[model samples]
Target chain A: MALFFRLEEAVSDLIHDGDSVAMEGFTHLIPFAAGHEIIRQRLRNLTLIRMTPDLIYDQLIGAGCARKLIFSWGGNPGVGSLHRLRDAVERGWPNPIEIEEHSHAAMANAYAAGASNLPCAVFRGYEGVDLAQLNPNIRTVTCPFTGERLACVPAIRPDVAVIHARRADREGNVLLEGIVGVQKEAVLSAKRSLVTVEEVVDNFGPRSPNAVILPKWTVSAISVVPGGARPSYAHGYYSRDNSFYVKWDEVSKSRESFLEWLRLEVTA
Target chain B: MSYTSSEMMTVAAARALRNDDVCFVGIGLPSAACNVARLTHAPDLTLIYESGTIATRPAILPLSIGDGELCETALTTVSVPEMFRYWLQGGRITLGFLGGAQIDRYGNLNSTVIGDYAKPKVRLPGAGGATEIASQCGRTFVVMQQSARTFVEKLDFLTTLGHGRTGRERRELGIRTAGPQLVVTDLCMLQPEQDTCEFIVTSLHPGVTREQVQQNTGWPVRFADTVAQTAGPTADELAVLRELNERTARAHRSDS
Candidate 1:
């Protein structure tokens, strides 16, 4: 059964040191609050996973909470570069985090494979591409029926998956409307899943046609954290704070300011 | 309203779109061009984002793929897998626009890194959906500001394979798309040589000289026999562009 817990308590109980954690959001509904809670709790050496890692992952890497990152794309969207992530990769400022990269299709498929309890995902990709040579995990498998060679990546069964959604019912049925990415697959693939919602409602009466509902049995825990996906938007709740992304470019440029802002805003 | 050459480039790019084309739009300038086309000429144009929003008709310019306006205004949304498998790989998208850190004379793009693969001096954002977009779309358009640095003789890494590798090689590799057809840059327009498949200067923007275009390109740029002056932005185009910008600002204000 899904249980409700306070933000800090949930983080303490669910996330541990050195866990492979997948925090997914396409562009909106990023679980910034949960990421902050993980940082505040001072967890260390976690392997963070996502498709397009943006502000929160940079914060986690800056805080030295991550040892590895499994991702498809990592950048501050619209902005140029993720300075903190660059610093970690180049100078090993806080710590040198290892990276295992994949394309968006491969990552999505790997998550699906994990959700389906499969060992690996076979897809048509990485043909004549250098990305395959760099990552050994992306190998080739010949189709038994057609004699076609396809790409294979191991299923990403993470220890924990965390995501933010628009709302959830008291019975723990989560409703994710608008631009649903691989969150559902990430949740089903993980051993434990934490969902931070904008609100906890008695019933998820109506939503947009594109909404995805994660039934109670699939979810491990739920926490109601308003403004959880700040900087990123929630549908019908608030708009994306575009200025924050521009501001983050300046904030994360140098080590001093990044840590200073981190202490004042996140850990504080 | 008087328009700058940059705006001219945007308008010209927008004008190239057909009425019913399904375009996979990139983040920045491509989004602007595609939206302008939708709002003005290409009313039935379908805008797809890699984030899975299909046929999105955003009132405002989306800052990112996950912008709320895109989700709110989309015809429908699907999962990432379905978007890639059913729409992209299934050959449903008609056009795609690409922007990258570096582009070669052959139209191959590099967005991965500025230096070596292992230890890059400048690590660019890795490919999101550009690889698939370039490979799968019926035709692709590249929009960027061209310079010696960007229009390089050789890409640092080939993130999206264009015509540089040749049609025969692409066919052997099972890449079916026609690759990049037109490259609309700040200064001029380029199309691939029919035989060699290298991008050649087709039309230079008004007031831009062939020497200037060649100087900006890193390689020895080839020009068409009859290089023509690209038409400047029309009065209607300028008006539409301005109205679009104003509406985007208004929408941003309303959202805030």
Candidate 2:
């Protein structure tokens, strides 16, 4: 069974220091509020994971909450560089954060493998690419029958997976619609999961054809945080805050402005 | 009215698409080009976004893959795993459109890091779906502004395989699909030499000279024996492109 709590209480109870966490969202439904809550609570030394560690990861990294980042891509999306992420990697201003990079295919497969209780994810990837040279975790395995070579990366079973969804029922079943990323796999692949939703409904209404229904038992805790995935939209709830993304370029460029902005918006 | 070089490049890239082509679209130039194609020549073009929106027909240009317009207008949406495992790796997409920070003679891209991977001067966004898209899509079309800084002789890191290996070597390694077919730049368009798979200038956009193209490239650039000037954007094409831009601006205005 899953328990429901306020966003602050949930973050305090579920996340801890030195935990490997995946705040999974592709470009949509990125649990910004929950991420901010984690920052507010001053969780430290987290190994943060995502396919594209955009604004939220930038915030987490900027706040000195992350020890490492495992991701495929990191950027401000349609703008230019993520300055805070760049600051951490290039200059190590807040703290020296380690990085483990993979391609989108590998990350998706790894998450699936974790969900399936597999040791490693096998895929036809990294062929003639140079990432294999740098990352030791990326190696090759031969198929049993065909004898063809394939790339392999260890399964990503995180300590905690956090996500934002459109809605959840009283029974704790969650509904996700529109451009659903690896949220389901991220939830299942983790030892524990935290879900934030736009609302806690009496019953999940008639869903769209493509909605993902995560039943109660799969989740550990549910937090009803309206506008949780702000800046990154929550599908039916709101549109993506494009203006804010454009503004982030300026605000995140310098340390003073970034820290001030974080202090005012995220921590305050 | 005369069009700018950037607009010419976008129009040319858009005209390259045919109807019903499943284009795995990226952000920036690729997105603009594909959407232009959708609104005009390639109305039936199936736009597959990395965010798992398949056959998306957005009302306006999407700011990013996760733009709400994409999800709201998509024919159907799937999870990220399904998007990669079934659609991309399954080789269902007909084309992949990309933009990159650096590209080598072989068209191998480097969006990862600038000087060194460990100690970097500039840390670029690493490969998202670009690695698989460049490798697995039936073919890829790269759109970038022609400059020595971007069109490099060698990449800092090979993030995606374009024609890094010859056909024989690729066959030996069990890799298939023509990697990058055409690279459309503001100055000229390049096609790989059939034998060497080295990108060579096949056509120059109107008013752009071979000398100008050569001056911008890092390596000694080669040209086709019969290099031709790309036909300027047609009146209808310009009209459509302008309308698309206007609509995008209007869309963003209302959205904000």
Candidate 3:
């Protein structure tokens, strides 16, 4: 069974230094509040993983929380580059960070493999692309029966998985709607999981067509955090603050402004 | 109708789409092109986003791939794993649409890094879905604003395969998807040569000279035997595109 706790308590209890953390959300239901809490706690040397490392990961990277980033794409969505991520990789602003890159198909399959308790993921990927040659994790496996060569990558089993969602019942069965990315597979792949939800309801009365429910037994803990996915937005709850995404381009341009953001918005 | 050259480029990209093409839309220019195609001529076009929104018809442009607008308007949404496995790799997409920072003569893309991968000048957002899209889709369309920097002689790193140094590389490797078949730039439309697999200028936009195309291209670009002048965007296309963009701008600005 999953227990409900405060955001800070959950972050403190679930995350620790040097942990391999996976905060998986596509663009919707990103756990911005939980990320800020992790930063506020000043965790370090963490291996952060996500497919698209958007603003939340950028903030964590800027605040010097991550020692490495494993991601497919690391941009500001429709906007441009993540300056903080660039600083860590290019200039090593707070600290030098290691990076492991993969394609979307490879990462998704790897996560699913992790969820299935498999050693590695196999798929037809990166046939002639140089990305497979560059990364050691991306290799080939020959089919014994058909004599076909397929691409394979190690599973992504993280130490902790964090995500935001629409609602969680009193029994701690979480409900996710709208653009559900790899959160379920990520949670299943991790050793422990923490979910931040818009509300904790008595029961999920009626569900949407594309609703995904993670049973309580699968989750470690939950936190009630309304508007937790601010700037990113939650489906059917609040509108996406698209302007903040646009404004973050300027705010995260320089280290000084990023620090100001930390002092005022994050740690304040 | 009077339109910016970029608007002409977008229209050209949209015009390339047929009613039956199931386009896997990327973020920026490709998104604009596919949406324009859906809003204008190719109303039956099936648009799939990386976030697993299949056949999404958004009224306003989404700032991110997983924006609620996309999910709300989509015919159905699936998990990311299913999207790549059953839909994309399963051969549902007919055309893969893309935009990138740099391109080679073979249409090979480099959106990963600008300089050395280890020690870089600028680190770009690495390939998201382009790699699989390039490999899985039946054909690919590239939309971009052209310049010598983007149309490079060599890429710093090849993130996705278009055609290898020798075009027979894919055939040799037993990969059969037709890679980046069409490229639409602000100045011209390029199609790969049947023999060389090198994209050569096939049609130039109105008032854009061959000298201009050659000057902007990094390589010694080749022109097709009968290079044609592309028709400018019609008033209806321009009006519809402008309305869509304006509504998008208003929504993002006001909602923020």
Candidate 4:
């Protein structure tokens, strides 16, 4: 009843070149460590989708693993800015960078729609604007109840979704304490989902049933990696390394420096 | 009676803010208003953010605009399309709260450029979603500390459309959102006239003077015929806001 794979093996097998991949983790917690390793292996032309990306995406792009990036913003707070990605976009680098001008809610909703097998989720949030024109995939659908027009966002089902969690059972049942907004939806919407955990519990009985964010039914692979989000922060386990964030800002000022930093942090 | 400029700006923004409004909050002043609303009057008020979070209810003040805490604590998350199409363009968001590097008399915002579009005196943070949010929101609330440099005669570039070319022209362009409802500064609260989009002082914070405000403005600032005094921040409000900031600092420090 247990499915297990090495972090590197699972990511390499699950994610092929040019695959549409969505990695879970916000600014700090639960980043896809194993996915980053796979990306380091030089898998070319991968398209990444997230609400907002960070150092992981920057490293991928710098390594030539990424072809296109879909997100709103990518940077560390105050320090460690988003110079690599910004320079790439401003310089008209060969990569196709698509900018989503809305809030993170839109990205999560797209996955929710995909998981529920709905064509689109009607949202009455943004009404009369040119935001629709920015992204070719979105359109307007009339609300059935009020007969008012609402935005119909297309489903985003990625080929692979790699997530990091606090704890997991051998069977890949995850327990994500604190914040768990779109974690479930992201897992359910992907064809294959991989979870990296701080610790692998001996049995399912150890974790509170209510705290289990993603059950074994959805996870294809589980790897136990202590001190995940190493450069970043993992709540309750480790604090964020401020030095790294500060260093990122300095490195991000130029592409050459950024690539060198990534090589040290990711490849080394 | 003495308060920091940040506190004055935050209190004014909170008092002027209404319930059930979708606010495109920036970091400092917008964050204060949004959090104060959550603590005081509008607990259920939906916050549609540019970071793609709709109805975000952060337990503490976010470290930055793109803090994962916003998405983690949000009621539901959506894509950029839904944020713009459903909430912003759908005419559901009643108010858009913003701050900027430069603002003009006509209420135009310039967060993208400083000197010129191509070449700039000082390259500011590029227009993230403020441009779209300003143009599309039902109404916008601008909060900034009073300064001549920030309150400019004319913006270097039009990042967000305020009244458009002309006040009447906004309606003709099918801009459903009324645009730039209120501007909250450290010294005063200003509202644009319906016809001209010219700001008139509606209220002055306690101890601030008309001459002081005028001196800080880049152009000849107008004033309402009957201006009122700004409400001061309560002890409880200050405590809550401080607690939020403390927690955020701790979180950042711990993580760092």
Give TM per candidate: 0.96, 0.98, 0.99, 0.74
When 2 and 4 are scored with TM-score, the better candidate is 2
Q: How would you encode candidate 4's per-residue C-alpha lDDT over B10-103 as one tens digit per residue?
A: 8768866677666777665688778887777777777766545778888776655546677677776654444555666566677788877777
Question: Model 3 misses residue A45 by how many Å?
Answer: 0.2
List, residue by residue over A96-214, the lDDT tens digit for candidate 1: 88989888878988999999999999877766666887889999899999998888999999999999999888888899778888999999999999999999888877666656889
Off by over 4 Å in 2: A208-211, B165-169
- Candidate 2 lDDT over B100-143, as tens digits, reads 99987778889999999999999999999998898789999999
Local accuracy of candidate 1 as per-residue lDDT tens digits, B1-256: 4668789889879988998899999998899999989988999999999889999998878878778888789998888877877888789999999899899887888888888877788878888888778888899999999899999987888888787455345667877779899999989999988888889999999889989998999999999998988988888888878887888766655553
**Fnat (0 to 1) per candidate:** 0.52, 0.81, 0.89, 0.10
RMSD of each: 1.7, 1.4, 1.1, 5.5
Give the per-prediction TM-score of chain B: 0.95, 0.96, 0.99, 0.93
For residues A14-53, could you state the per-residue lDDT of candidate 3 as single tens digits?
9999999999888988999999999999999999999999
Q: How far is candidate 1 from the true structure (C-alpha RMSD, Å)?
A: 1.7
Query: Which regions of candidate 3 are displaced past 4 Å?
Result: A208-210
Q: Model 4, clash count?
A: 33
What does candidate 2 score in Cα RMSD to the true structure?
A: 1.4
Sorted by DockQ (best first), the order is 3, 2, 1, 4
Superior candidate under lDDT, 1 versus 4: 1
**Runs off by more than 4 Å, candidate 4:** A75-81, A93-102, A144-147, A204-212, A239-247, B1-4, B14-26, B33-60, B64-141, B145-181, B194-199, B204-221, B228-251
lDDT of 3 at A18: 100
